[model samples]
Each structure stands twice: as structure tokens, then as C-alpha cells.
Target: MKIYLNDQLVDADEAKVSVFDHGLLYGDGIFEGIRLYNGCVFKLEEHLERLEYSAKAIMLTMPWTRQEISDAVCETCRANGLKDGYIRLVITRGVGSLGLSIKNCDKPQLIIIADTIQLYPKEFYENGLPIITVPTRRCNPAALPPTVKSLNYLNNILAKIEAQHLGYQEAIMLNDQGYVAECTGDNVFIIHKGVLITPSASAGALKGITRDTALEIADELGIPWREANVTRYDIWVADELFLTGTAAEIVPIVEVDARKIGDGKPGQITARFLEAFRRRVCVEGTML
Candidate 1:
């Protein structure tokens, strides 16, 4: 596979980062997971904007201009012959010393990888995936803001591991205050009383690009959608449950914890959103 490192596209095995790179040593970096469909990048500007937002959050400056980065992504996609695939763009505090000072690190790494990704099995999407609410609460935004898409994903990974051990495909993490924050890698939502509701950013949820797009789609379809702090009580009594992310897209949650959601099947509104979401991606955004 071809990887975009700096301004060049090279074999993945050959692309390298400095050992002292803070992104590797101290997780001092930000990233974005983007999608390309039919040779066109989905919400390319929004993803870049978020990447910049994350970089700024950490006081790191991107070495490449946004246009340069966008071009590199397209070039990587073309080189890899990707019709539909995932893009992982990363920027890190480059080559800093072991003592955690950013002074010596005069460079930042810009790496982009374009490839296919399927976070869950096809059957899971077909049958609706089950989610377990793990005990591993989300990292408090006060401790480390969830808005910054940093490399430190151990918290989310641990929850996912718990889900795997429990024989479920995905897991949800609650915030410190016992509100439903998000899944291991996706923001979650539920339909209640004909309204689509999701945890707000203050709830410790990642402000997911796909999550916002789903909200827009909901509005377009005349399905009421709103952002608010969501608790377990909301999840248990909701008419429908679903999760959204760049990679996960839109997936129905048939069961949360031990309770069945909407007759233990994908609810009508969940199905509707999924259908609308699936159709919107190919039609929306910048096409290559």
C-alpha cells in the first residue's frame, strides 16, 4: 500500500517517523479518520477543519497548508487505486527529547494512509449490533478534552476489549457523571418520543463528523434531532438506539446493557436514519 509521508507517497513499510517523535513517545498528536467514496472524499473540509482544531488544541502547528494536506490525501487515494476507502491523517510533535519539552522538536510529521476499513462485520450491520456499557468511564474532558483527536486511545481500546470478552461487537462508555458519553469509537444516540437525541459535547462525547451529518440528515428528512446530556434512563426507555462515526457510519443498537431496545430489533427510526445516511454520503460533499 502507498502511504503519504510529508510530501511524498512511498511504500507503507518505508514510511518512518523519528523515534523521539512526541506523537510516538507521549501521544502528542492529533488525527482525523476520513472516508473516500467513488474517488471523492466525504466532508473533506470538515475533517481538515477538525484536524486543525485538534492541532490548535495541543499548541501544535501543521507544517503543511490545508490545501497541501488535501492534495496529498487525494494523491494517496489515487496512488492506491481506492474507489472507496478510509483515510487516516496524523500530525505529531516531531522529534522531541525524552523529557517532554517541545523545544527541540523543530518538525511535525504529516502522514496519511488510505485503505479499506470495516470496523464491524456485515452481519452485525444487518442484524443490528449489541452494545455493552462498560465500567470504564470516558476520560473526563477536564483531564483531556475529547475534542482533541489525540493518539492516546487506551481508554476507548480498553472498553472495546471488554466488549470483545463479553461477546459483543461494540461497547459504550459513560461519562464521570453517569451520562452516556459515547461508544468505544463512535458517538451514540437514541430516538425517543419521535425525537432523535444524542449526548452533547459537554457530555464527554467526541464531536463526531458523522454524528453531526446524521443530525443534518435528520433535519432534512423532518426527523427531529437534538443534542443534550443523555443518561442511562434515556437509553433504557428510548424507542430506538444507534451509534455514529466516520468509520462506523450509522449502526443500530438493538440492545443496551441487559435491556432490549425497541422489541430487541432495529427500531423504525434507526432504520430510517441508516437508510437516509447511506444514500446521503455518495451524494454529499466534495467529489474527486
Candidate 2:
């Protein structure tokens, strides 16, 4: 395997970062999870754009332009002979002293890894996944906006651990106000009376790239869609429930909190959106 570090591609075993890096010390970093299909990078521009936004939000300057970053990603994929895989792009505050100030850091470090990732099994995609709502509420936006995909994922990790202990594959997190935020690593969407609904950004949900694509698919398929604040009850009685993410793609949620969602099966609209999403990705992407 090959990893893109700084500006050079190196063997995975040789790819290394400083132990004093603030990204590892204080979680001062941002990242993006991208997908490549048939040598094509899916929504490369959008992912880069989001990466830039996150960097800016965290005051981390990028040494390379967006185009250069994109090229590096393609180059790394080619170097690894990856026709289909996942890409993890990370920008971290470089080596720094044991202090809480960014002034201690010198520069930023960039790393890109292209590898295969199976976020969920094939059977889960077909039979739908059972999830639970955890007590770990999402981090407040005022503290750290969910829109920025940062390296500090302890909140979600705790929720995931709770779900795992309970024998569930994933966990849903609510905002401080008790509104449905999202899942551990995916955006949540539910269908109610033919309308596609998801939490707005203000609800502490990450503005996911795949979540936006799903909205576009809904529009193309003539399915009514809107963003609004949703509660646990909305999901409990929703006609269908699903999640979207760069890795998770689109997968149905059959049960939440052990209660069956809409006859405990993948709903018709969910299936339609999933099919449309798959077709869209195969034909629409940046050629590697």
C-alpha cells in the first residue's frame, strides 16, 4: 500500500508523523473520507471544498492548492493501483510543544491514504441494520460545529461503544435540545408521508456530502424533500429511515431502539434512492 504524505508517496509502513503533532496531541486537525469507483473519484471537488472549509474553520493553512490536493489524491490512487477504494485526506497541526496554544505548532501536515473500506456488510445493506439511540448527545455547535469534520470524534466514539455493548451495529445521537442530530458516522434521514426529511445543520448534524447527494437524488426522483428539526418521535413513526455518508453510502434502518421502522423492512422510497445513488456514482465522478 502507498500513502501520500506531505508531497511524496511512500510505502504504508514508512508513512509517519511526528509524535508531538498537535493532531495527535490535541486533536487539532480536519479530515475527509472520499470514495473512488472504477478509477473515478466521486465528488472530488466537493470533498476538497469541504476540506478547505474545515481547515479554514480550524485556522489550519494548507500548503497546497485544491487542484494540487486533487492531483495528489489521483496520483496516490494510481501509485497504489487502486481502481476502487476509499480515500482519507487529513490535515493536522504539525509537531508542537506540550501546550494548548496553536502558536506552538510550526506547520501543518497533510496525509492521504487510499484503501478499501467496508463500513457495513452486504447482508446489512440487504436486510437493513438495527440501531439504538444512545445517551451521548452530540457536541454543541457553539463549542465545535458539526459541519467541520474534525479529528475529535470522542463523542461519537463513546456512543458507538455503547451501541456495540448493546449488540447494535450503529447508534443515533441527539443534539442538546433533544432533536435528532445524526448517527455515529453518518447523516440521518427519514421519510414521513412521502416527504424526505433530515435535520438541518443547526441541529448539530454534519453537512455530509453523501447527504446532499441523497437530497439531489430525491429531487431527481420527484420525491418531496426538506430539511427541518426532527425528534425521536419522528423517527419512531417514520415511514422509512436511512443513513448517508461517504463510506456508508445509503443504507436502510429497519429498527431503532428495538422498534421496527415501517414494517421493519427497507421501504420502497429507500430502495429507490439507493438504486439511484448507485447509478449516479458509477456514471458521475472525476476520472482518476
Candidate 3:
């Protein structure tokens, strides 16, 4: 296996980072999980745009130009002989002092890994997945905006642990105000009365890449859609429910909080979106 560390590719066993790196000590870093399909990096430009947005939001400077980063990502994919896989692009504040100050940090480190990932089982995709709502609330937007996409995922991790302890694979996290924010690692979407709804960014949703793709597909298919605040009741009675992310792609949710959604089966609209998404990925974005 090969890993892209710093500005070059190295053997996975040889890739390493300093123990004092602020990203390790204080979770001071940002990352993007990208997907590659049919020898093409799906939505690669959009992912890089989001990466830039995250860096700017956190005041972290990317040491390389956008073109250079894109080249690095493609190079990493080629080095790993990946035609269909996941790519994780990360930028962390370099080695620093023990204290919380960024003043002593040397520079930022770039790491990219391309590999295959299956976020959920195939049966779940075909049969629809059942999930629960966890008590752990999403971080307040004012405290730590979801748009940053930083390394401090302890909040989501705690929610995931809670769900797993009860024997569930995924969980929904509501904002402090009790409205639906998102799941542990994916964006939430529900179809109701012919209109598709997802939480707005202001509602603590991370504005995921796959979520955007789903919305675009929805529009292309002439499915009415909108972004607004969503609640547990909205999901409980949704005609169809699904989650989207770079890693998770599009997954249908059959049940939430023990309530069966629309005969407890994946809806036709959900299937349409998924099919359209699959078609688009193969022909879209940068080729390797």
C-alpha cells in the first residue's frame, strides 16, 4: 500500500507524523473524504472547494496550491492502483509545543490516503437500514460550526458509541434546539408528500458533498426539494428517509426511533435518486 505524506508518496508502513503535531495533540486539522469511481474522482473539484472553505473557516493555511493538491490526489490514486475507492485528504497543523498556542506550530502537514470503503452492508442498501436517535446533541453552531469539518469528532463519536451499545449501526443527532441536525457521519434527507427536505446549514448540518449531489439529482429528476429545519416527528412520518455522505453515498433509512417509515421499505423516489447518483458518478468529474 502507498500513502501520500507531505509532498510525496511512500509505503504505508513508512508514513508517519510527529507525536507533537497539533492535529494529534489538539485535533487542529481539517479533512475531506472523497470518492473515486470508474477511474474518475467523483466531484473532486467540489471536494477541494469544501476543503478550502474549511481551511479558511479555521484560519489554517494550505501550503500547496489547489492545482498541486488536486494533482497530489490523482497521483495518490494512481500510485495505489485505485480505480474505485475512497480518498481521505487531510491537512494538520504541524508539530507544536505542548501548550494550546498555535504560535509555536512549525507548518501544516498534508496527508492523502486512497483506499476502498464500504460504509454500510449491501443488505442494508437493498432492504433499508434501521437506526435510532442518540441523546448526544450536536455541537452548537456558535461554539463550533459544522462547516469547518475539523478533526474534533468526539461529539459524533460519543453519539455513535451510544447507538452501538444499544445494537444499532447508525444514529441521528439533533441540534441543541431538538431539531434534526444529521447522523454520526452522514447528512439527513427525507421525502414528504412529494417534496424532499433536508436540514439547512444554519440548522447544524455539515452541507455534505453527496448530499449536494443528491439534491442536484433530485432537481434533474423533477423531484421537489427544499432545505429547512427538521424535527424527529418529521422523520417519524416521512414518506421516505435516507442519509448521504462521501463515504456512505446514499443509503435508505427504513425505520427511525422504532417507527416504520412508509411501509418500512425504501421508496421509489429514493431508488430513483440512488440510480441517478450511480449513473452520474461514473461520467462526472476529473479522470485519473
Give all candidates' CA lDDT scores: 0.89, 0.94, 0.94
User: Residues 73-101, candidate 3, lDDT per residue (tens digit)?
Assistant: 99999999999999999999889999999
lDDT of 1 by residue, 116-190 (tens): 999988877778887888989999999999988998899999999998999988988999999999999999989
Ranking by lDDT: 3, 2, 1
lDDT accuracy of residue 120 in candidate 2:
93
Better of 1 and 3 by TM-score: 3
| lDDT score at residue 75, model 2, on the 0-100 scale | 96
The candidate with the higher TM-score, 1 or 2, is 2
lDDT of 2 at 66: 93
Candidate 2 lDDT by residue in tens digits, 45-114:
9999999999999888888999899999999999999999999999998999999998879889989999
Q: What are the models' TM-scores?
A: 0.97, 0.99, 0.99
How close is each model in CA RMSD to the real structure?
1.0, 0.7, 0.7
